[model samples]
Target: MNREQPDPPAGGDRIRQTAVRAGGDVIGKKVEHHHPAGPVTALHALPTPPAGFTGRDALLEELLAAVDPTTGADRAGVVVSAVAGMGGVGKTALALAVGAAARQRGWFCAELFVDLRGHTPGAQPVDANAALDTLLRALGVDVEKIPPALEERAAFYRSALAALSDRDEHRRPVLVVADNAAAVEQVRPLLPGPGGHRLLVTSRSTLHSLAGARRIDVDVLTPKAAVALLAAILGADDSRSGRTEELAEVARWCGYLPLALEISAALLVRAPHLDPARLARRLAQEGRRLERLDDGERTVRAVFDLSVQRLTPGQARVFALLGVNPGPDIATEAAAVLTGLEAEEAEEVLQDLAGARLLTSHPGGRWSMHDLLTDHARHHLTHHTGTEVEAARRRLLDHYTRLTADAAIHLQALPGEAVPATFTGTADALAWLDTEFPNLSAAAYAAQHAGHTDIAVALPLDLGVHLDRRRRFDELISLSTLARDTARTTGRTKAEAAAWNNLGAALAGVRRFQEAIEAHTTARTLYQQTGDRHREANAVNSLGAAFLEARRFEEAVQAYTTARTLHQESGDRRREAAAVNSLGLALAGVRRFEEAVQVHTTARALFREAGDRHGEAMALDSLGTGPGGVG
Candidate 1:
């Protein structure tokens, strides 16, 4: 047994030796460890602010206060501020100004800027996912490491922002300026969670649904601010041309809107010696204002067109109608009338327009469009609205004509007048006319140009008495001229006669006696040719007034005599009373006081028969007072 143990021990030694050698071989292999590289530094990726950027100090301060990373130590999420307004209202300019200022103040370690292209003329808006991919690459993340899914990428982006803030020994901040963001979804994923980061978003949309965002609305520049901006753009030499009044006129014509002012200033710079007064004169024409406020690459109208192009079909139709609207602003009820929708339905469309920044809402449920936007809308009305524009124009004009005719009945009525059901009383009628006077004037001209001959003829005919009451003589003349031309083109004989009569009245109001006589003569001939005895009598009365104005007393007497006879034949007692009163004036002009008194006495009786108490009172006063007879 002793001999066997000794032999095994000797064998076990070799095995032990081999095991030791294997252990040594394993221990001999080299060992290695890896660690991640340090974070990137010095990121500066913001576009330069526009040259000569001026104004918006108050807005800049608000933006700076909202986006200041230093003040919100307890806050963890990124601060977001939305700058919104109509296109070309300086939202981008204000945003750029804030970004440049923040960068200069050393408030950020990295900066990012992107144009969302939400309202670009011919391009689609940039996808938020793709925009994130680009942003990740900019932040020094490897392209391969970026996740393929949008949600994953967005998660990774937030992590990266958190990691960057954490890794930085100095605790530097990041700034992002998202330009032209179309909607909330496009910007939601890009925002950083509670951290040392801030976002500034600028858009043509109000972006009201963007959660937790500080909203800033940009409006048209104040007149002084606008003029100063123009001066800044045009330089001291061009702006100080001893034509400050003209410069101010130019600013007003531009609607005190920045894009228009900038474009006009640029035009002035290019032409140098083109007097500001001349430019103002050109812009004074509303039809040509947009044309003059355009450069080759950019235009106020083009900018506004892009904003309109983004509207929904219903919203687009309303926008087009707004362009054709003749007033400075529109109430919800009036807008309803224009769109042929219920007031509530039209109000919803108006809210959509306001949200898109295509229209601005004022107090009292009213809305206004920018001057340039109106021009662009009109352009769309001409090209995009197609045949619907004609129907729309007719509806618009009919609404105005019917309402105005009703109002005229309360103010002053002719024979055979029918009141519109819309008018409840004289006060209501006058209030409507007062509110719609400007639009009524604009509708007449718009109808004439749009080839709505019937509307053109009816609008001025119904609105003329209101215009006369307001002493809007120039506008009256313009409406009358347009109506006359439209009536002639459409071969509406009675409309032509009415147009000529209104034109004669308007011309007389403006002291153009000779032109007034010609217009009245043409009206009389047309009315007589059409065998419209009542209207012919009215035309003859108008001709007699023109003769009296021209000091041709004998011709005035003859015209008034013919008008009185025609009114008697037509059984228009009211107009016969008016003609007799005019005959009394002509007789008085010819120094026949006794004949004037007799004529006035007969006129008073006719006025009473016609139930015109005011006409009777005027005739009584005329009979008592010699030189000032009423007609």
Candidate 2:
């Protein structure tokens, strides 16, 4: 440590001056600056303590990869590693150690630590702007000049950190550590310029949601590391003097948790007269039972419990309900339904949990708790009453009901067909539909079992348009089967007919002509049974299309003629035009061009009268000439 005092600044000069940095650590040099404010929170201490800090080697590699010159055309910019893991798993310890190691290797000019207090549980997370204020003031920025808005504060933080980084690009470098981050959003504001600054963040969960962020998941220290840490704290000579079992027992009892080891060592230091073997026996008796090892008021469980208490009733409900959410991660939309809150509110809650380092957000915006945290949260919220569970299920069902209905209406809109304006948002509704497709199928299946027959039948009908757009014919077929089964169960002839029509369309799109014809024939039977003559004609028309694709013109013409008679009798001009167009094509295929032309001419006239431009265009293209020309 440098013993020389920092040079005193001139009187009345409020702009406290500090070293901007000139690359590489200046050994034994102390930066002279007037800190405009008192230190906010002295970091827990440098990484001088002994800890194994397991599972971070892979994380360090990821961080290095981000700044690897080969990436992004071989340029140099500081790589950001959000060191996230469960509480008491040594995020801060790992970060401090890495910073110290970087300094020893001359990779940085200096290192600074900022605790964002993201995991303080009951305490509100430190605002981004406030963190900036502390950092800027610490770096010699005037306290009164700090920006109030979070965005502006962030800009200033980047600029200030960048100035030091730029100073390092040519000479030495300074790496900054912003630890205990609350969320990606909070950290995003403080990220140094994509230049020389290396940021290492430690949190309780992975920060994979941050684009380009390198994630390091910290777990308990290895037993070897734990023993090493014990020896470091309790004295290596004393530890190895034929009483190693105490250290090993202490390490094991602490779950190899570094923080717990430190506390245990503190206890040992204060009670040196106590026998080591007796201490080991005491710890052993507390097997798997975590005693409150808080130093007066700071215990790991207390820290996490406070955060849990800060969650809303709905958020708390989701945190508990998701204990049973089976998967690696659950999408935001599914989580929203799992909780009773609206999608937006549920998303906000997830953001809160993510910021608090209780959850990890993934690509495509799904989130999950760390394995350790997940297990603990499940244990924490085990008091969910039976009534609460039922209420949650009801909310979930309600959410799916509106979601599926909205999807159905949108599907109807695909052919520019009019559907009721039931849903308030089209974009969000469609996205929800897309993200929840599998869950929707499962829900539909469950609904059918629960006697929600129409819901089971209609959801697939709603998704038909978009799924067709993606050419998911197999999924469409599966959906149609559910609809058909539900309709049969409920004795709903119209729904059954609709299911057949959907099935036929899916089969036709995939060129499964025989299956397509069978589906259409089934739809025709159901439509006729319901006395929906025009619908029956439409089914016949679909069968004609399948036959046409299969090169069965005679069968195609027979189906088209039957459809045309029904359309003409019903005065359904659009259906009449379609039937005529099909009949003409069937005739043309059979080398009867004259009849084909005549039929197409009649179809074109009807399409024009109906004001259907697309239909009229098709009709005009079909005759292949004007009224008097050849087909």
Candidate 3:
């Protein structure tokens, strides 16, 4: 092999020259090569599905059936199901559940998830054009090539889906999960036309106007299901502690709402020895319920705040007032009164709230908020409304005060007395008072605490008679004390006198006659200083009643005489009649029968002149039965 062979023939020279020429040509020109773009095999952009998702079996099944690709060939367009509910009602959870199930079933090759940030706190909703750009980019469209306008972007998205559908190798169905969609238009451009694809949307609103979208309203879990969820979260060891009843109570206190249940369960899971009964008792307090439901990052209040942030200013104001409202539910007219809105306008606002699931509508044209939502609204009112809160509260108090004062005049006004034009009859007045009794008390307390002195002073004066008639002495005592303090702080002498007078009445109702006398005496001095002869006369009359109750006859007679003289000077014949009747009782208390009889005769004449048949009857009965008859 190593031996040199004979030199090649002269043909080698031509071969070398040809080879050199080929090398020079290759070196002088560039080579061009082409490769095709690879297909997008899979996309997993959805959030991980919630863990241990419990209940909602029916809703889940319906959602799964809605987006199942096998049925796409039989349908006209891509199936769209809108999952809507109040915040924390598990709207996103249901959508994720269906999405996970679909992925497991191999329903789609291209998957997409976008948080529209519709009602997210501290974030504006995604713009439709921007959202479309996101979808185009997600579909492998280059940023520069993607259309800038919404319509073009939408067209491009559809074309992309069409191209994918036409490719036999990549013609797998697509699944899009749009979470927290704020508005219809925000979602419109993102939806695909008729094809082997589906979209599942979640929002606080129903998005009812979105054409061809099936809506599923996700409500709170059923009681059995809620308890089961709590148990599932607690695991075996904690759930079987003979505290099943307490667990049920815990769920009930959570309103059987899934979000609340999970938060409550988390607390128990952290403290393995913590009694379920203890947690139940803790949640029993409404003021503390929302606080207890917080777990640092995911709070019930935080969940509710997002929905509240989306409200219009008027709706937000109405919601704040609803928080301050003491009733379990509100009639539209009542809400109108609370917010100073026209009834129709207020109803529209309430319906908007109901549509947003911040409020729920009952059959009787009334609206109610969930217990936790009410707390959240109040929280917002306390922190965000600022000076407007004071003004709004004043308006609420003024509304209730005027209506209640009118009601009292209708129910308790003496014949021939001028009263506010209100109520169809005494029965109507009584019914209104009975229905508003608790609210009236709550308003009075709230006003006093918030330093609205006028409202506090006026409230008990209007409500006292009804409360006395109903034997609601506890509320009377509480309201009157607060009124006294508030009036004194504001230095309104007439209001202070009125507050003391009401306080005396409440004290007497509870059989605290000594304190009642002291209160009445204070009232008399304040009235005299203010030069209010009529109220001074009223105060002296109350002072006499308290004296008589304490068996101080001489003091009682002296008090009644002073009241009678003042009433006569003030030209209040009706009250003069009342004072004269009381003087007769004091006279009988000291065994002065002759003077008592003369006083009684004078009282009878005054009562007749005043057209007070009831006062006349009382005076006649006193004449027949002596001192005991007056009371």
Q: Across residues 1-631, which tens digit of lDDT does each residue of candidate 1 receive?
A: 0000000101111110000001001000000011233333325767666555676778779888777888865222222333343567777778888888888888877777766766643234656876776577568764335564678889998887777767777777787777877877788888877776887787767666767777778777777777778788777666454456777887777777676676566556656677777776666544254565444213355435444554678888899877757656778887888888899999999987775556777767988765556666777777554667666667777777777766665554333344456777555776688667657766776676666777777777666655544434456677777777887988987777777777776676556889988988998899779986766777787788778767788998999899889878977676678778768877988888889888989988988997767667767766655454333
Per-residue lDDT over 325-378 for candidate 3, one digit per residue giving the tens place of the 0 to 100 score: 754566787788777789899999998777555777876677766555676678
Candidate 2, residues 11-114: lDDT per residue as tens digits? 22221111100111100111111223332322222435234344456655555554332333222223233234346666665666676666656665556666
**In model 3, what is the error at residue 217, expressed in angstroms?**
30
Which residue pairs clash within candidate 1?
76-194, 76-195, 77-193, 77-194
Give lDDT per model, in order.
0.66, 0.59, 0.66
TM per candidate comes to 0.52, 0.50, 0.52
- Number of backbone-clashing residue pairs for each candidate, in the order shown: 4, 15, 0
Which runs of model 1 end up more than 4 angstroms from their true locations?
Answer: 1-317, 375-385, 414-418, 628-631
Q: In candidate 3, what residue range of length 10 has the lowest lDDT sum?
A: 15-24
As a TM-score, model 1 comes out at 0.52
